[model samples]
Each structure stands twice: as C-alpha cells, then as structure tokens.
Target: MATITLTVNQAIRELSDIDPTTPLLWVLRDHLGLVGTKFGCGKGLCGSCTVHLEGVAVRSCTMPLASVAGRSVTTIEGLAGEGDELHPLQESWIEQDVPQCGYCQAGQIMSAAALLNGNAKPSDDDIDTAMSGNICRCGTYQRIRKAIRAAAEKGGAA
Candidate 1:
C-alpha cells in the first residue's frame, strides 16, 4: 500500500493509504467517482474501461494505479472541450445517434479520440484496427464508425 497523488481531469487528487496495485478503473470509478469509464471485463479484453493516459487510450482495468502517479489521466468525463462544449466526436455521436445500450460508448469514444489524435483522416482499416478492442454489445459498430468519420471530417481532434 502507498499514498499517492494522481492528476485526474486536470485536477490534483491525493489518495491516502491506497493499494498501488489497484487497477486504475476501480480507482477512477470507486475512489475518484469518475464512473463514465465502465467496467465490462476485468481481463482488459473489453475496452469498456478505456481511458486516456497522456492522450493515449489504455485499458484502465489492468493498469496499476502506481503506473499513473506522475502521469495525467483523462476519463470519459474529461473529454469535453470546455464548459458545455462537447468534443467533435461527442457532437457526431449525438448527430449520428450512435449509442444503443450506451454502456460502451464512452470507451469507444475515448479510443476513437486517441485514434483521431494521431490520424485526422483515418481509413476504414484504421478505424477497424483502432477499435478492434472495444466491443459494443448493442451492435452499434456501424453507427460508431459513421460517427467517427463525421467527427474526423469536422476536425474534431486535429
């Protein structure tokens, strides 16, 4: 066990007597009260617990809290641009009606945001490669893809 301070959503959060081995997902959801990063599979196979570590998407379920002590973390709740200003992917999501169960949408968007941060114009193959880890039980893959493309076209991340 260790006392650690993590930078989350642009805020400094000090956690006392925390287990460093604890997965980041539980820390964010249970400790930090950032529940938008859902818990689907504890094995990290499902991307439901995906979040950004230094702007790169990672599986929060398997990531140790100790790994993020000095680094910054961004959950789905922090994806918005500014007050009441949604990220381009968020706007496209609403415009495209992408969510069905909505359980995996946050993770999907986080992963897509990472992808878009690297590739402004992601090919279909790029989208598939990037989103292969995220599983949407509601079968909203098509809509997700469309929304991603739309966000890209609108210069969401770039």
Candidate 2:
C-alpha cells in the first residue's frame, strides 16, 4: 500500500494506502466516486472502461493505478465545459439520438471525444477505425458515426 497522486478532471487528487497494482477502473469508481467509466471486460478488450490519459484514450480496467501517477485522467463527467456546457460530441450525440441501452454510451462518448480531439474531420473509415474498439451492444454504430461526423462538422469537439 502506498500513496499515489494524479490529476483527474482538471483537479489534483491523491489516493492513499492503495496498491499500485490495483486497476485504475476500481480506483476511479470505488475510491474517487467517479462511476462514469464502466466495467465491461476486466481484460480490457471491450473498451467499455475507456478514459483519457493525457488526452489519449485508454482502457482503465487494465491500467494499473501506478501507471497514472503524475498523469492526468479524464472521465465522462469531465468531458464537458464550464457550468452546464456540453462538449460538441455530446451535443451531437443528443442531436443524433445515439444512445439505446445507454450502458456503453459514456465509454462511446469518451472514445469519440478522443478521436475528434485529434482528427478534426475524420472520414467514415477513420471514424470506424477509431471507434472499432468501443462496443455498443445496442448496435448504434450508424448513429455513433453520424454523431461523430456531426461533431466534426461543428469544429471537431472543441
């Protein structure tokens, strides 16, 4: 057990007495009370536990807590702007009606946000390639693609 410090959602957070080998997903959900990142497959294949590490998409479930020490992590709750403002992808998501079961939407959105952050205007193939890791059991792939394109049109998830 040791103390690990990291920044989350633009805020500095310190976790004490935590095993460094502990998965970041549990630390975020259980310790930090951020439940937006879900648990799908513990092995990290499903992409349901996706989050951002230094503005890059990462699977949190298999990421060790120590790996995030001194780094910045962003969850779904932090993807928005100041005071009720939504991210472009979030707005496009709602406009496109992208959620069905909604269980995977948070991860889906996080993945989309990362893609749009890097690629201002991604082609259909680009969107597919970037989002292929995230699985939406509800089969909302078309809507997801549409939302991503919509957000891209709105200036690339700024």
Candidate 3:
C-alpha cells in the first residue's frame, strides 16, 4: 500500500494505504465516488474512462494510482461552469442533442474538452482526429462533431 496525493477537479485529495497497481478508474469510482467517469472496456482500447492527467487526456483504467502522484486530474463531474450555468460544451451538447445512451458522454465530453483547450477553432478533420479514440456505441459521431463546432463558434470555452 502507498499513500498518494493528487489534485482532482481542482481539489487536493490525499489517499492513504492503497495498492499502487490499482487502476485509477477504481480509485475515482470506488474510493472518491466520482462515478461520472464510466467503466467501458476496463482497458486502454476504450476511452470511456478518459480523464485529464495534468490537462492531457488519458485512459484512467490503465493508469495506476502511483503514476498520478502530483498531477491534476479532471473528471466529467469537474468539467462544468462555476455553478448551474452549464459549460459551453455541455450546453451545446444538449442543444445539438448529442447523447444517445449517455454511457459514453462523459468520455466524449472529456475528450472534447481537451481538444478545445488546445484547438479552440478545430476543423472537422481536427475533431475527427482528436475524438477518434473514444468509442460511442450509439454512433453519434456526426452530432458530436456538430456540437463541438457549435461550442467553439459560440465562445463556449474561454
């Protein structure tokens, strides 16, 4: 067991006595109770467990708690406006009707947020390339792309 400290959703968390090899997905969902990050393949192939490791998108299921020692992690629950205002992407997602089953939405949103952070005015190809890893069984790719573009244009993210 190892003690690890990390910044999650801008809050510092100190976890004492935990297996280092345990996947971050379990730590977030099981320990911290941040269930927004879904469990999909439980492997690196699926991006359902995507989260931001120091502002970079990564698969939490394959990442061990030991590796994220002092990094800032952002989950779906953390990606939003200050309060009930709703993030631009969140609003655009709803406006565009981007969710089907909603199982993959958290990963989708996390991936999209990363993309927008780097490239605010991403083209269709950029969106395609950045979001390619996330798999949505509902196949709402077109709508997802549209919502991203809309959010970018509407100044949804600063």
Candidate 4:
C-alpha cells in the first residue's frame, strides 16, 4: 500500500495508505467522500461510475487507483460553475427535464461533457454513439439528447 495524491476538482487530494489495486470509483466515493460518481455495476459496462481523468471520461469502476496517481479527476460535483452557479449542461438538463429517477443523470451528464469537449456540435448519431454506454433506466434519453444540444447551442463544453 502506498499513499497516492491526485488532483480532484482542481484541488490536490491525498489518499493515505490505500490498496494499489483499488478501483478509482471506491477511492473517489468511499475514500475521498466524493459520492457523485455512483456505482451501478462492478464491471465497466455501465457508465454510472464515469469520471474525467485528465479531461477524458473513463469508467472509474474498472480503473485502478494506481493508474490515476498524478492525473486530474473530475466528478459531477466538479462540473458546477465556481461559487454555486450551475454548468450550462446542468442548466440545460433541468430546462429539458432530463432526469426521472436522477440516479443515472450524473454519469449521463459527465459522458455528455466529454462528448462536448471533443465535439461541440455533435449530430444525433454522434450523441448516440457517445452516450451509448450511459444507461438510464427511466428512459430519459430523448431529453438527454435534447439537453446536450441545448447546452452546445449556448457554448457549453466547447
């Protein structure tokens, strides 16, 4: 076991004496008190545990903490604007009524953010391809797509 320090939400977080093979999802949620990244499946199939590792969205459940020693991690809580303002994507989410159960929305948003970071104006197929891994049991996909477009229109994640 070794101490790992990582940049999370623009702040340096030191994790003390953790197992090297521990999943980054647990490290974020259980160790660092960052529960915004949920655990839907222990496997990497579901996107519920998505987080940005140096601006690229990754499935935290399958990612070892040792792989993220010096990388910057961005969770749902980090998406908010400074000083309590909501991200444009988040605002668009509420405006488009994207969440039903709300359990999967955070991962959905994070995935969308990664998509937007790469392609600001993604087509329907693009959105579909990017968000395919993020499953929402409530079936709010149409709203999720709509919200992504709305956020892009307003210069979000661009």
lDDT of 2 by residue, 2-97 (tens): 999999999999999999999999999999999989999889787889999999999999999999999999999999999999999999989999
What is the Å distance of residue 89 in model 1 from its true position? 0.3
Instruction: Sort by lDDT, best first.
Output: 1, 2, 4, 3
Query: Candidate 3, clashing residue pairs?
Result: none
Off by over 4 Å in 3: none
| Better model by TM-score: candidate 1 vs candidate 3 | 1
Model 3 TM-score, all chains together: 0.97
TM-score versus the correct structure, for each prediction: 0.98, 0.98, 0.97, 0.97
Q: Between which residue pairs do clashes occur in model 4? A: none
| Model 4, span 86-109: residue lDDT tens | 988999999998899899889999
- What pairs collide in candidate 2? none
What overall lDDT, based on C-alpha atoms, would model 1 receive against the true structure?
Answer: 0.94
Runs in model 1 deviating more than 4 A are none
| Per-residue lDDT of model 1, residues 23-87, tens digit only | 99999999989999999989999899999999999999999999999889998899997789999
Candidate 4: list runs displaced more than 4 Å.
none
Q: Candidate 4: minimum summed lDDT over ten consecutive residues — where?
A: 149-158
Residue 142 of model 1 has an lDDT of 98
